[model samples]
Target chain A: MTAAPAAVEARDLSKEFDGRTVVDRITFAVPRGTTFGLLGANGAGKTTTILMLLGLLRPDRGEAQVLGHDMERDRFRALQRANFSSPYVSLPHRLTARQNLTVYGRLYGVSEVRRRIEDIARELRIEDLLDRPVGKMSAGQKTRVGIGKVLLNDPEVLFLDEPTASLSPESAAWLRSFLGAYRDRTRATIVLASHNMPEVEAMCDSVAFLQQGRLLEQGAPRDLIRRHGKQTLEEVFLEVAEGDTGRQQGPGDLA
Target chain B: MKASLGRIGAMMTRYMYLYQVSPIRILELVYWPTFNMLIWGFMQEYLRSATHPAVFAASYLIAAVLLWDVLFRSQLGLTLGFVEEMWARNLGHLAVSPLRPLEFVGALIATSLIRTLVAVGGAGFLATLFFGFNALELGFGLALFFLNLVIMGWGVGLAVCAILLRYGLAAEALAWGALFVLQPLCGVFYPVSVLPDWLEPVARALPATHVFEGMRTVVQDGRLDIDLLAQAFLLNIPYALAGLAAFLGAYAVARRRGLLMGTGE
Candidate 1:
C-alpha cells in the first residue's frame, strides 16, 4: 500500500538563542488534507515551530521535512508549492492590493497570474479595494488582502498564523465558514496556530496540544472533549490549559 | 542549468520592473544624482577661480561628484534595501524562499545597476544641458563612467550592506555619511593637490580618486592617461574584492545570529 503523504513532519527539531532553549527538541507530524490546530498560550514556541517548518528558521539539530522536501536541502522547491499568511507581516503598504498580488505571483512564477489575482481578490471579497493602497485599508480589509495575496498562487500547503486574529465576532464567524468552504473545495492542508478554541472546535479535524514547546496530546477535538467528560471544548481547553482535565463544565462557559 | 537561468532571469526582470516603476524607487533614482550634480555645479563655480589652468574648471568637481555617487549611492542602496525589507517584513520571506543571500544580493545589484545608469545619465545630461559637458564629445570617458562607476559602486554597496545586516538600525544613518567621508578623502570635490602633501598618497591609494582625476583629465582636455587608468585598476580591484568578501561574511553571520529574522523590536 502507498503511504499517505505527510503535510509536515519534523523530528528532533531544536532552536536555541543565546543559551536559552526556545523550541527544545519538539517533533510532530501532520497528515495531508486536514487542519491541524496547534494550541498553547503565548511563548509556547508555537510561532518558532511554524518558522522552522516553513524554513524561516533553521534547527540546530535533527531533521525537518515539509511537503516531502527535506527542510535544508530542498526547502525552496517545497516552499514553491506552499504559502504562509500572517496578520503581523504587512504586505507592501505603498502598492495597491492588486499590485502587491501581481508582484508576488510573478515572483512565485504562477501561471495565468492576472486571472489568479482577480480570482483571489474576488474570493477574499476585496475586489472593490483592489486599487486601494494596502496602508489605507481597515484591519479587516487588510486581513482579507493578506489572505488574497497568499492565495494568489494557489499553494498546496497553507499555514495561517492567527488567521482571523482581529475581526468582529460575526465577521470571524463568516471568515471561518468561508475557510470551511475553501477547505472542502481544495482539500488544502491547513496548519493553523490559533488561541480561538471555538474556532478550533468548530473547524479543526484534529488538534495537537502544545505546552512549553512540547506536544502534550493529539486527537480529534471532539473525541478529546468526550474523553475529558467536558460539556464544551472551552472547558476542555481550560482543563487542559490549567492541567486540570478532570473538571466538569458546560459549553456555555467558553461562550 | 538553463531552466534555473530562466527562473533567475524572470525574477530579475520582474523585480527590476517593479523597482523601476515604483515612484519611491524612481525618486531614489532621480533625487541623489540631481542633488549631487547640483552641489558639484555650485562647487565647480567656486573652484573655477584656481583650477588646473590647462584643464577646464567644471571638469574636476562635476566628474568627481558624479563618480562618488556611483560608489556612495550604490552602497546606500544596499542599506536602504535592507531597511525596506525590514519594514515590509519581506526579508524573512525571501530568506525562507529558495533564494540564497547571493541571489538576493544579485537582484539588489541588478536594481543598483539600473539606478546607477539613471543617475549617471541624468548627471551627464545636466552637465551637457546646463554646463556643456558632453561625455560622448570627450570620447571613451562615457564607457569608463559605466565601468569604473558600476563595478566600484557595487563593491562599496556590498560592504555597506554587510555592516547594516550585522548591526541593527544603529549604523543605517552611516549610509548618508559614507560619501561625505569617502569624497573628501578621494578628492572628489577638489583636486588632491589642494590637500596637504601627506594626503596625496592617501588619495592615490583610493581607486575613486584616480577615476575622478582621470575623468577630469579626459573631459577637460580630450586627453587620456594610461598611468591613471592603471592606478585605478590596481587600487579598485582589491577594495572591491575585499568589500564583497566582507559582505558575504556578514551574510553568513547574520543567518546564524537571527538578525535576519527582522526582530529588532
Candidate 2:
C-alpha cells in the first residue's frame, strides 16, 4: 500500500487583527488517519487557529493547507471535502432533524443524501428525534444532531470545537468510542480542541499544547509524560504551561 | 462560472425551501403584505367618498397597494434571512465555505425577487377580490410601470439589507419605515398634485415616488408621459446601482471587520 501524506500542514502561519498578531508564526503537521488534539486555556487562540484552518479566517502571513488544498487560495476544494461542528453554533430550530440534515447534505452535494442522513441519524442514535423540531430538543440532543450533521458528508477532515462541552460523562464516553470507530473506518483526520487534558491524552494520537496563540509543545501522550518525568499527563500539562518544564535544549540547540 | 452558478442555485433553492417550510417566516411574509394592504384598502374607500377624485384612482390604488411591498418586504426579506443565519450561528458554516461575495449577494437578490413576487401576488389577489381592480393591467404603459416598480424596489431593498447587516434585528424596523417615506413621497397612495412644493423636490429625488406616481399615471390614464417615465428610470437606475455597490461594500466591510459573530454576542 502507498503511504499517505499529511492531512493538514502549516508553514509559519500567522494572523493579525488590526496589527496585533493573534496567531503567531507556527508550524505543525497532522498525518492522515490521526487525531491531533489542540490543548489550551481560554483565549489561547486554539479557536482562531481552527477557524483559520477551516478557511473561516485568513492569515496575514505564511500559509496553511487543509486536505492537500491551500487554506488561502483554492479553499473551496478544501472546504468541499471538510466539515466542522460546534455546540455553540446551532441548526435551524424550526426544522426537524431530517430536514436540517437534508439541507446540509444537499449543500455538500453528497450522493444518496437521504440514505446518508438516515445512516448518520441511526449512528448518532437520534432516530426518534428525527421528526421533532430542533429547538424543542435538549442540549444533549442538539449536540447529537450537530455531530450527525458533520458526518452527513463523510468529511475527509472533521474539526470538532468543544464537542463534549455540555455532554454528560456517559454521553462523552459514548461519543468518544463512536468517533474512534468512525475514524478507524474512514481514515478521516480529526482536530479536537478542548481544555481537558485527560480527554486529549485518551483521544489524540498527538497533543499540541497552546497558550496565548503559541504552541508550547507537541508530542504523543506517553512521550510527553516521559520527557516531563511526570506521573500523569495533567502534571505534565501544568509544568509546561507554568514554564517549569519543556525545552530540553537551548537556543541553537538540537536533539 | 458554472460551478459558482450551481452553488448559488443550490443555496437559493435551500433558502427558499426552508422559508416556505418555516411557519413563522411564512407567517411574517403573509402578515406584513396583508397588513399594509388593509390600510391602503381603507384609504381607497375614503378617497372614493371624497370630492371629485383623480380619475383612474382605482387602478392606482390597486397597483400601489399590491406593489408597495417591493420597497419594504423585499428588503425585509433579506434582513430576516441574515437574522436567521445570525440566530442559528450558522454564519460560520457559510463563511468557511468557498462561497464568493458575488454568490452570496446573488442568493440574497434572488430571495428578494421571490419575496417581492409573493408580496405582489398575495396583495394583487386580495385587491382584485376586494376592490374589483386588476393588478395585471398589461399595456405598453403598464409594462413600463412594472419595470419601474419591481426593478427599483429591489434596488432599494438591497440597500436596506446592507444597513440591516451592519446593524442587527432591532433595526429591522427601518425596512418598514422605508415604506412610510416612499408611500407618501412616491404618491403611491395619493397624487403628487397634493404633495407640498418643498416636499415634492425631495420626493422627486426618491425613485419610488416617481415609480408609483408613474405607474398610477400610466395604468389609470392609459398615457405614458415619456418625461415622467424617463424621470422614474433615471432616478431608479442610479439608486439601484448605488444599492448594489452598497451591498457589496457592506459585505466587504463585514469581512474586513470580522463583525460576523453569528450569535451577535
Q: Write the per-residue lDDT of candidate 1 for residues A92-114, one digit (tens) a residue.
A: 67668877777677667777878
- Report model 2's chain A TM-score: 0.92
True-contact fraction in model 2 equals 0.39
Per-candidate fnat, comma-separated? 0.28, 0.39
Worst 10 residues of 2 chain B by lDDT: B256-265
DockQ (model 2, Cα): 0.39
lDDT of 2 at B144: 67
Tell me how far the alpha carbon of residue A138 in candidate 2 is from the true structure, in angstroms, after superposition: 1.8
Candidate 2 docks at the CAPRI level of acceptable
The per-model DockQ list reads 0.30, 0.39
Share of real contacts kept by model 1? 0.28
Clashing pairs in 2: B186-B209
Any idea what lDDT model 1 has? 0.73
| iRMSD for every model | 2.9, 2.4
lDDT (0-100) at residue B174 of candidate 2? 72
Model 2, residue B241: C-alpha shift (Å): 4.2
